[model samples]
Target: MPHLHDDALTLLALGEAPTDEESAHLDLCPRCRADLGSFRRVVTAARQAGAEEPGTAAAADSDNPGLQSPGPDVWARIHRELNLDDALRNDPLASPNAFAADAFDPARPSPAAHAGTPQGNVRPLAAARHRRTGAWLAAAAAAVVVAGAGTWATLRAVDPVPGPEVVASAELSPLPAYSDTGSAVVDRLPDGRRELVVTSTGDDAQGYREVWLLAPDATSMVSLGTMEGTEAHFELPADLDLSRYPVVDVSDEPYDGDPAHSGDSILRGELDL
Candidate 1:
C-alpha cells in the first residue's frame, strides 16, 4: 500500500481517529506507527509541564500586595537567548511548556532590586528564575524533533519516505528531425514499484509531446501519455515487462483523435534495466 500523507500523520499525532481505511493502514504499517508515537510523546511532555506550573490564581490570591509579574526586559532576554519565536512556530504544544524567563540572578542587579522589591516577593521570583532554564530547554527539544531530525531521519520517521531510489537513468540525444535534449530517470519506490521521471529542455511542439517505452527490436512500444511540461512523473505500468521494453523514447504528438504513437521520434535511449 502507498504511504499516508503528512497532514494525515499530523491529525493522527493530535489524537484524532483517522478514517477506517487509514486506521487499518496504521495498524499494519510500522513506519506510520513510529511517526504517531513521536507526536504523542511531545504532547504528553507539554501536558506534564502545564500541570507542574504554579497557578495564576495562586499568585493572585497571595497575601503579598506588592508582588508584580516579571517585567518585559526579562522576557526579551529569554526570547533572544532561546529563539522561542522559531520554536513555537514549529511545535505549537511546546508553548505550554514555556518557562518563566524572569529567573532571579543574584549576580546581576535587577532594576526591580534597586526599586526596593519587597522581601516577600524575592523567594518566589528566585524560584521562578531557576525553572526558566528548564522551560527553554524543553522547548528546544520539541522544536528540533518537530523540524524533523533532518530529511533522512524524517523519512525514517514518516510516510512517502526516503525519496525514490534511482534504479536506472538514460540520456536521450535528439534525432535528425529535432535538436532538443532530454533525460529519463527510473526510480524504485520504497514499496518496490518503479517510477519514470522525464526531464526535457525542448520547446512545446505543434501538438503535445508523448512518452514511450520502446522494445529492443524497435518494432513495439507502450505509449506512456502526452508530456505536460518540461518535467513529469509517470508510473510504469505494472504488467509492462521492462526486459522487453528497455528503450525510452519521446516523440512529437498531434491531437489527431488517435491514441497511437505519432511515429515522429525526436529523442531516444536504451535503459540499462
Candidate 2:
C-alpha cells in the first residue's frame, strides 16, 4: 500500500483519528511513523507558541483598540510570495462567490472533455469530488501559509532586532578515525548572554554527539550540552572563563548512563579569543 499523503498526516497531527487501515500502516511503517511524529511535534510547537491566558488579551487591551481588516492588497502579496496560480490572483475573501463561480464553472471543459472524449461519458460525481478536493487543498495550503506569516510577524515583534554578534570562533578539525570538519563560534546577545554555535559536516555515529569545552592541558572539561543535528546552540554560563577552556571538542557519546566523555572525539578546535 502507498504511504499516507501529507494532507492525511496533517489531519492526523491535528487530532483526527486514523482509520483502521491507516493505523495498521502507521504501526508497520517506520517512515510514516517518523513523518507523523514530526508533524505532531510541529503542531505541538505551534500550539505552545500561540497559547496564552484567557483574560490576558482583555487586560492588555483595556482601551478596547479598534480592529482593522487587512487591505485588499494583502491577498496579492500572499499570492506573489507563494507563486500561486494566476487564476487565484483575485481576492477570494472580498468576493467569495465570484471566486467560487470561477473555480467551478460548468462551461469550463474538464480534462476528459478536452481530450475529445464524450462529455456524457464523464461521471459528474467524480468530477465534483475532484473539484471539491482541489478547492479544499488550496484553502488548506493558503491557511497554513498565512498562519506561518502571522507567527513570523509576532516573533519579529518580540525578538531583538540586531540579533547576536560573534565574539570568538574556531575552525574544528576532525580527529583520527573521523572525517568530519566543522567550526564553532561564540555569540554575544543584546542581553549580555553568550552562546556557542557549532556547525559541522556531521558524523555517522550510532550514538549521540556532545559539545564540550576543555582546558589546554586536557586536565579539565565542561560539557556544554548534547547536539541533536549538524548544528546546535548552547548557552554559555555567564561566569564561564573562555581563556581557561579555549578548546572546543565534539565527541560521539554512547548511551551507557555515564556522564563522562567517551573520549571518542570526532572534531576538536582551539578557539581564537
Candidate 3:
C-alpha cells in the first residue's frame, strides 16, 4: 500500500483514532510510526514555543505571526536526527544552558535540566536509524505532539493552516546525499505575502546548512538563511522573481566564516508552478 497522506498523518499526530485499516497499517509500519512521531514533535514544539514567547496569545498558529525557533529539547532531537556534531551542545561559549535561559521563558526547563538526558535513550527519530526515510508531510494542518519514551502529549489543532494551495512545489532529491529527502512549498496568502516553507533533512550532521534559491543553470542565486532545524518558513521577497530562481538548494557548510555558498549541495530540486 502507498504510505499514508499528510492529512492522515496530521490526524494521527493529534491523537485522532485512525480507521480500522489505517490503524492496522500503523501497527505494522515503523516508518509511518516514526513519521507520525516526528511531525507530532514539530507541532508540539511550535505550540510550546508560542506559549513561551512573551505576550503570545492563545490563538491559531497563523494568527501568531512571526518565526521563532523551537526550544532546546526540540533542537536536541534535531541534533539526534541529523546526527550533528557536538559543538551545538558542547560549545563552552555557546553554552546550551545559557542559550536556553535567555532565549525564552525561564518557566520552561533550562538547558541544564535536559543536560543529563542520555543521548542513548532511544527516540525513534525520523524513521529510525540506517533505514531510509520515506516521504514526509510538512507540519501543516498540524497539531503538535511531544512524546518521550512511551509518553506523549497530543494537542488538537486550534487553527491549523488550511492546506495551502501549492502554487509551486517540488520534491527534493539527494545530491551527495545519504538518505536525505525534502519538499519545497510556495504558498501565497490572502494578504499577498508569498511564503516559502521548506522541509529538509540529512544535513543535520554537518556543522550548519544553508538554503538557497538557485538559478536553473546553477549560476547565480539568493541566500534565504541558515536552517537551524529541519523545517522552517522563509518569506519570499515581493520583488524577488521565482521564475528565474526556480530551484531550491540546500548545502552542507562548515563554520568557515564565509557567507557564500560552499558549493556543496546536499539536496536540490526544481520548482514547477
Superposed Cα deviation of residue 103, candidate 2 (Å): 50
Output the TM-score of candidate 1: 0.43
Q: Which stretches of candidate 2 lie over 4 Å from their true place?
A: 1-160
The top-ranked prediction according to lDDT is 2
TM-score of every candidate relative to the true structure: 0.43, 0.42, 0.43
Error of 2 at 102 (Å): 49
Give lDDT for model 2: 0.65
Pick by lDDT: 1 or 3, better one: 1
Clashing pairs in 3: 43-144, 44-144
Ranking by lDDT: 2, 1, 3
Q: Candidates ranked by TM-score, best first? A: 3, 1, 2
Worst 10 residues of 1 by lDDT: 147-156
lDDT of 3: 0.57
lDDT of 2 at 69: 27
Lowest lDDT block of 10, candidate 3:
143-152
Better of 2 and 3 by TM-score: 3
lDDT of 3 by residue, 204-265 (tens): 65668788999989889999987767887898999999999999988888898998889888
lDDT (tens digit, per residue) of candidate 2 on 116-146: 9877665553243234343344343333323
**Whole-model lDDT values for every prediction:** 0.58, 0.65, 0.57
